[model samples]
Target chain A: MNSLKPFSLLKRIRERLDLQIALAILCLATAFLFVGGYLNYLRAQEQERTGVITMVREMVAVVEGNAAIAAYLQDLQLATEISAGLQSSRYISMVSIDIDGGGLVSTGAVQSGRSPDFVLELASPFSAAETVGSIKVYADLDYIEKLAASKGRSVVSGQLALLLLVSVAILWAVRVVVTRPLGSVVRQLKKINLSDEGSINQISTRSQDEIGYLADNINSMLSAIHAAYLSEAEQSRRIAQLERKFRLIFEGSHAGIVMVDGQNRLSLANQAFQSLVAHLDPHLDQQEPRPLSQLFYDPELVEGILSTVRENNASVFRDLKLAGEQEVWVRSLFSLIESQNSAEMGYIEVVFSDISDRALIEKHFEYGATHDQLTGLLNRRGGEARFRRQVEQAQSRAGSFVLCLIDLNDFKPVNDIYGHEAGDVVLKEISLRLKSALRADDVIVRWGGDEFVVSMLAQSSDAVDAVGRNLLSVFEQPVEIRPEVWVRVGGSIGIATSDRVGFSIERMVEAADEAMYIVKKGDKNSYQVFGDSVARSQSQA
Target chain B: MNWMIKAVWILLAFSGSLYAGDILVVVSKDSPVDTITKRELVDLYMGRSHSLPDGSPVMKIDAPVDSPVRAEFYQALIGMKVSEVNAYWARLMFTGRATPPMSVTKPEDVAGLLARNPSALGYLPEDSENEQLKTIFVIKEDQGAP
Candidate 1:
């Protein structure tokens, strides 16, 4: 029952509109019927009053005329009979005789005291005659009663008929004018679909009434609301689609991307970025935020990036070494985000895009330009630059260094015998052996086809000679080109020390060349150092 | 000329007697029975107002609709005029209380209804009765004539 209470109350209220309308109509009809009935009653009463007055007046005239007739006859009994005859013929109640100054004569019925008040007077029919015996006549009001009753009934019945007809007409009119239109509006409102575009159906505006105006306004409002709803829904749908596309781009990009805030703290790092950092510095995989400074081993590099960004207010791209181990070239793009009030919110963006492959390719191009392609060593141009820089530094510091020149003795014959391809392989193998014999700081150059040079920085002339002998001993073993073929390639070496000879890089290379020719003239397997005599002889020649 | 005058006089006297003996009654067309008992006739005319003793519907008839004869008959029987009867019926019909009596203009019509409908109650001159229709009651001329 408690649960049903709300439902029942709702039902009652829902039924109230029609119920109230019906009740209002009933009340209006009842009031109209009552007013009409009362009016008809009043009309009948008025007519009855008028009829009664007229009948009384007519009865009085007849009574007066009869009195004159009675006087002319000069017979009391005959006059009485004449009055009785008139009374009976006319359906009058009574006719009476009165003497000149005294008493009454004959009467039809002994009159009751309850008789209605009447106007009495003496009269004669002739203008010039004395009043005869006065006659008292009682007015017959039965006809008035009958007339009033008939009129009252007719009026009531007529009024009732009129009321019935009018009430039906009014009820029908109200249903059409008010109820039906309102019901239609309600039904349309219920069926209105907020999702569909142009769903609002226009209501009629034919009438210039308040209801018509209200419907028009409501329809316009609904149309606006529906349009707004559809527009917002469409915008949100497009936004969702763009968001999905952005997510795909962000997640699927191969290049590592890391977003840094203005505070130099890592804000967002994509999966690629995380993997890149892990590859560059395995320690970065620890559960801690790596500062940009810490990610780069060089403080100067970090400061350069920050200063560039601060000065230019733009992005910076450079090749950077990660923790002094791995070199990753990255292009960073940064931008500032501001609020609507134009206050700087923060910096957001990506330091992304691995140009490592590009960097490797560029390194290869640089290496190709500076080094010989076959022997994997510095060419003449690169070797000259290295010799000059080393000599200049050694001269300033009173340091000693050595330069060696070697020319392969049987290289051309081996190339002519086994073809140039085997010759190239033999050259590559020789370059590998020479690199292995020398220290990392020493420079080896392929001077030309079947010719090579080596440069080494040293502390003294003895150190220079030891390094030169080690270079000469590396070619003592015969090189193997194939399983059955051992190619015994040999080269004559000539060494020159920077402090002892005191020559420029080119002059030192010329002295070493002269010494190398002496070795070749003696025996190809041996080596010689350029002494002051050889240099003087060469200068004189 | 004297004999012709005598013959016309005889004819006139006969017609006068015939009319004096005749009466008329009227009833509604939908009345169920063709004849009524004497008791039912007395009750209906006298306004005693009861159904027929045999449990049939009793319908009282009125005289000529607009004639003085209607006034006289109703007045003699029920102490009211034709106008009063109409008013009574108007009140009944308006209030949804009762149906009004039907009316016939001629005595022959009354006699015919009486012959056809057993529950029909009406008045006629005493001399108007025949084997086809039964007389329920007789009233002297002073009582009422229609």
Candidate 2:
């Protein structure tokens, strides 16, 4: 009883519009036919009555003289003949002749003893002074009644046939023009492929009726739906492609990236991100990131991001580090990601990169006290010294400059799978390529292993990108480390220029870092430039 | 149109006239009577009395029901419609008390039948002539008679 649901049978019938309309018409037609047939039957009864009376009257008129003669003769046989002639009428039950002097002579087909319908009498006179005898005519109703009944039956049958034919025609016409068409439309609606825009167009009947209007309205509605579906499909396809590229970048980059939901649970984390978190706490690799406070070496960054997002919606830090034996450093950017409805800030997106070896960050507080011996290029310290010199020169002299970060592709496999001797040889080969590709005014610095920073004294952003592209093209062909020992390496470069407005040395380097991440995120072995306007626009984004 | 004419004839016969002709109350030349009044004529025709004014047993001769002259005769004599006269006779006959007048479809037959039965009485067209029958009275049609 608890599981049973009540369905209304009447409601189900009411919902069928065609049945409702057809029944209404059929009921009206049946009523008209019934009334008309009944009236016709009544009229036939009257006609049969009149005809029977007229026939009996006519038969009496024909036999009047003979009946008088028979009555005068007192001849029973002659009287019987007069009565027999009336038998042909089928409506006479008896005929009688009576004379005062001669006894009554009567003859007829007697009924089963029921009263007669009517009696007719006429005087048989001997001369004018006396009526010597009389003739009596008795009429039976059976023949006229039978005839009337048959007439009624024929009328009824005719009316019924007419009603049946008319009803059949109405049903057929309705099925062809209304029910079948509507049924097809309903069936068409049932199987419509909502995803396909062309599925909206159907019902090719050309008419100016209500059904046509319905079809027209449906066609217009389908067209609108088709247009919306097409536009949405294009939008979703583009979004999926961008999302795939975004996921590839977030996962494939040397940096770690993750999203924490509004509940502070790790909603998304890629392999590099997992490894980075594992570096802080190794046991986090196989477990779901519940109680996010435990997954982090210090929960302060997440808590700060949450508090700031509650008020300002987003916050970023130049650099934050985890205290450990191997110092882990990252420059973090945080923002509150919103739901589609835009009614509330739903979650947080935190993007961070391994900036641990930015020892130049410390040197930016000092000057020129850094160098690297392995590749005879300036280390992080010298790179910061040269960057400060360029900043000061640009502010005082009002000159322009471009800063770029270049990351070596496939360097880890060469160093880890091969040996350090092969790694050193590969690094020296890249150093020689940079020397040959650059102008003498360009300052090149190897900031760390498999990382380089370059400063070109150029204001235009496009020329900076051209220089970056030239550097990438250098590594397109493999380098020869030994006799007939060939190895392939690719480079991804990020460029930024001080030519546009809002250019600080820090922002320029951050823009360059962001652009380098883009090249590594998509199809690799490419270069990208981040101009000042683009960097400023994306700072909040 | 034929039935309409018949209907008009019947109406004229039963209703006496539309301010025009009159009827001749006729009897056999040997009827042994001279004349009769309209009151006596009505009694003899309606079966209220079965005898003539001369105290002889009487028989009435009539034209057929559809005959215009017969309708006029009854209307003029007894002031009765054909259906009323037929009903009266039907009731009398059913009770075995009296029979209606002997009838012929032709007015000529009515005059001939009256000639043969001296105790019989009938009406005829005013201009009709017969050697064996005699007209005893001429009843004016209606109130407009001069």
Question: For every model in order, what is the number of clashing pairs?
Answer: 8, 2
- Which numbered prediction scores highest in TM-score against the true structure? 2
Error of 1 at A193 (Å): 4.5
User: On residues B51-88, what C-alpha lDDT tens digit does candidate 1 reach at each position?
Assistant: 66567667666656765455555655555666765764
Model 2: runs farther than 4 Å from truth?
A1-46, A57-88, A97-103, A120-142, A149-222, A261-267, A279-289, A298-305, A308-331, A335-346, A355-541, B1-146
DockQ values of all predictions: 0.01, 0.03
Model 1 misplaced regions, further than 4 Å = A1-26, A68-100, A105-117, A124-147, A169-233, A246-334, A338-541, B1-146
Residue-by-residue lDDT tens digits, candidate 2, A1-541: 5344334545655777667766787888788877988888888887888888888878788887656645543445666667777765677767666765767766775655655454444343223334656766667667678889899889888888888888788877887788777777777777777687464656555556887789788878977887898999999999999999988887797666767776777777777767766755645445666545455457776576666775786566646665456677777777777678653346677777767654446545444346666776777877777888877776676667788898988888888877888889998888878878898767789967898888867654557646866777678778776779888888777887787534577887788788888878765677777743232111110
Candidate 2 local lDDT, residue A330: 70
Against the correct fold, how does model 1 do in TM-score?
0.34
lDDT of 1 by residue, A1-541 (tens): 8999989977875764654666677788789778877787778967886766666557657656545534433335545655676466333566676645434555465358745335445543222234546666565557556767788888888878877787677767777777677767767777878887656676664446777878889888988888899999999999999999988888778766665556666666778777766755545445665566666657577756765675566666655656655666565554443346433344445556656775578679988888988777899888888887777777777778688898987899998899898898888988999899988888889999888999877778777556656776677787778878888877787887776567577678888898888878775666788883332111110
Model 2, range B23-71, lDDT digits (tens) per residue?
7888899988788876576656655457887789888877777876666
- The ten-residue window of minimal lDDT in model 2 chain A covers A532-541
